[model samples]
Target: MSSTDAPRRATIADVAREAGVATSTASVVFSGKAKVAAATRDRVLSAAAELGYAGPDPRAASLRRGRSGIVAVVLEGHLRTAFLDPVTTAMMDGLTDGLADLSSGILLMRDEAGDDAAALANAPVDAVVLIGCSGRARASLEIVRARGLPVVVIEGEAGEGIPRITLDNAAASATIARHVRDLGHRDVALVTLPLDSDRERAPVTDARLAAATVDVTVERLTGTREVFPDAPAVSASGSFIDEGVRVGRLLLADPAARPTAVLAQSDLLAVGVIRAAEELGLRVPDDLSVAGFDGIAVDGISDVTLTTSVQPAVEKGRAAGEQVARMLRGERGVTQHFTCRFRAGTTTAPPANR
Candidate 1:
């Protein structure tokens, strides 16, 4: 054949012909399955190069294998929120490390408020990891379960037949509360994470308390009450620094009714409370002591380290990954609970005599 009329492109059949072998042999060589002589393999490779033929199509291979080769990591909040929280980052890093053996890749799926569960239901994933899921996350999870895919929830409540990787949120919060109480702070206020999707910033009432959908919020709130039954609780829109500042200002505004100590749900919130205290010209631990959860590093706050609870976020993710691997191996995965350590920082001290 003339060069212009040469075969438009090399097909598997062309490669087999050029290699002087059966088409099935060429297929086996590309598939990397079955034992082929090294010389035959080299011939197939050389023939494939000469014919300009790429390897077998991945879509076709996936179809043959009956697997998507993808894992979906569903995030409860916006993507930006996940990036801002160091806990989420550490957990993700651990999960990725655990999944290193898998040839497939992880796909991030954000569960937006008001979106249907169809997206997750139809996603081409063999397994799923629910990251920081709240009550709204349950609906999508149900859909995933219906599809019969193995699921692992991180820092979420355990469902019937579902394995969970949980943190000691209550114990940690109680430990912090006990520290404040031991320091002579009888009156304490709480700045909590968003209780539900509405994310309203206001005083938490009986109604809102009953409506709380996030597991972490509920457990931490319960933990605090275990120590201070009558502690006043305020709900913030999120664990953001600005939200902390706003809620902190509100709680500390009233001199007569202000709490001597404030318990924020996350370190970011604690920092915001510290800023609000500075704005009001009140000295931390002397005017008001503040404590928070999550042992994350924050900048700009010198000598005023926050007394907080530190959870093994990366290890939690690693445990979830290991559980997923177990499920993939047809073994029932065990639920793992991690404990948090109470960190005494400079942000908390005895309440000043009023």
Candidate 2:
């Protein structure tokens, strides 16, 4: 056919005509909302493929249903860091699996909250899930709520009207401390997650402790204090191994002021502490004991397993996904809480004097 006389661009009406079905049937087939016979659905898909049609137009579908079929996952830091954390990875996996049945896709939105709150206010999402956010993130979250979208906060608490998916951060940390106390380690130090975006790395002082804005940091620190009221805590800029190593070296450098045990907020941090201990010629458990949270497997570290609290990362994600699904189905979604179990490993043991 001549260029001007070429066949018309395919539309849902054309697909419906080719499939010998009504436009509504064709829409249902593509949307997968209404139950259609398997054969009919297959016929609609085949017809659309033959016509080079890319199924329903998202713009048109969104207008018709008043929904975007997209859920935004608001992350607090760089995308690379979000993917590195086992906790975030596990939760994302579970959320993906849980939403698989719904055929909804996830849109990862980074909430840096610079100059303006444009991203949070303008995201084309029907709902949002806050992943590991704190401090200034709370302000962005308020914007998300103001936009009238349902929100689910994971690993952080949301005030009334927003649903929360929480882990027992305080109780779990306290449990880990109690384990250390039971091992007869009186002198202990802590390596904490970032208390704020300032990413400060220094000895956790009373002022720093009071000014902490991160919920996880606060909870874990509170838990540690339950046992070691005067435990010397140091804040790490992040949960990365390098940060852990830096904090570890600083803590172990001064033998005169070093503690017998170290409790890191993450497995990666714990591994760093172990490396630091070895660099200082301190033997594991024999001279120092270290413990961490999250049971993620670490590589290249031999003969030493981290003593940590094993939280259900994937399960937490799945639960969040299920909650999102419930909200979409016109159900009153409820908050969920999970706990971590302590895993005694080679990195921790009785104090050297024993």
Candidate 3:
């Protein structure tokens, strides 16, 4: 047909009429809701192909079902920064897989972006998934709840009645800490992720600990303290290598008072600590032992594998996504907990000269 004379887009009715079947039968062929005889289904599909009708409009179907078919993935920081973390990437992949059956797409947004909360409140999404939520992210809970959307939080507490996919944060950190302690590292220091919404990089004082709103950071710190009550700690602004380097320099610069070992909350921070140690002419695990969490691959950072805890990041994300799907489908969402494995890399050893 000529461009101007082209026929209108084909519809299910068109396919049904051409296939000599009812419109509902044609729809069932597409929705896979009811069983149609083999010959009828084949005829309907053939008619659809000939008419160039690729099933009903997804948007139209969603409208009919009263759903937006969009899931908002709320992160703690900017998108660029969040994607840099391997854990975030892994979890996102899993979430995508979990929502595969729904044929839904993800909308990445930050909880505390200038107007993001308001925008999210108005977005036409079926559900929201909060990744490692902090106080800043928690502040937007009211907005999401107000929209009457299903919520699934991963590694963050959103209070009762909200389904959460949690990790064994304290237990996993404790296991790693015990490994360091067993290495005869009497004098050690802790490098932590951000403790609160302020994202401060300074010594962790009791006041700051009490005010911390980041559940993951607080839980890891609790595990470390359980092993070393008197060990000094510095909270990095975020989980970036630069933040780790800055805090690492502060903790490792003073040779006289420098601890024999350092435990970082993330592999990136741990690598930064190693970089700091090397810049100060200290050999990792020889002059100053270093340990980290998140068993992410760090071949780019160093050859010395980082001793850390390997958590199922992708599974955590998938669980959250599955829960979101369930809630959206009028099913009860259940809380799930995951564990981590300890990796003994070359980075950790007995304290030098101890």
In terms of TM-score, which candidate is strongest? 3
Against the reference, the lDDT scores of all candidates come to: 0.87, 0.86, 0.90
User: lDDT by residue for model 3 over 206-297, one digit each (tens)?
Assistant: 99999999999999999988999899999998887878889999998888999999999999899999988888999988888888888887
CA shift at 92, candidate 1, in angstroms?
Answer: 1.4
Q: Flag regions of model 2 displaced more than 4 Å.
A: 1-9, 19-46, 53-59
Q: How accurate is candidate 1 locally (lDDT)?
A: 0.87
- Tell me how many clashing residue pairs each candidate has: 0, 0, 0
| Pairwise TM-score winner, candidates 1 and 2 | 2
* Residue runs of model 3 more than 4 Å from their true location after superposition: 1-8, 17-22, 33-43
Per-residue lDDT of model 2, residues 1-354, tens digit only: 788897877999999999999999998998888899999999999999999998767666665788888888888778878787777888899999878766787998776776446877887788888886587778878898889887788877688867788889899999999999998999999999988878799888888878877898889889889999988888998888888889999999998988999999999899888888888899988999999998898875796778999998898888888888888788877988889998999989998877
Candidates 1 and 2 compared: the better one by lDDT is 1
RMSD of each: 3.8, 3.2, 2.4
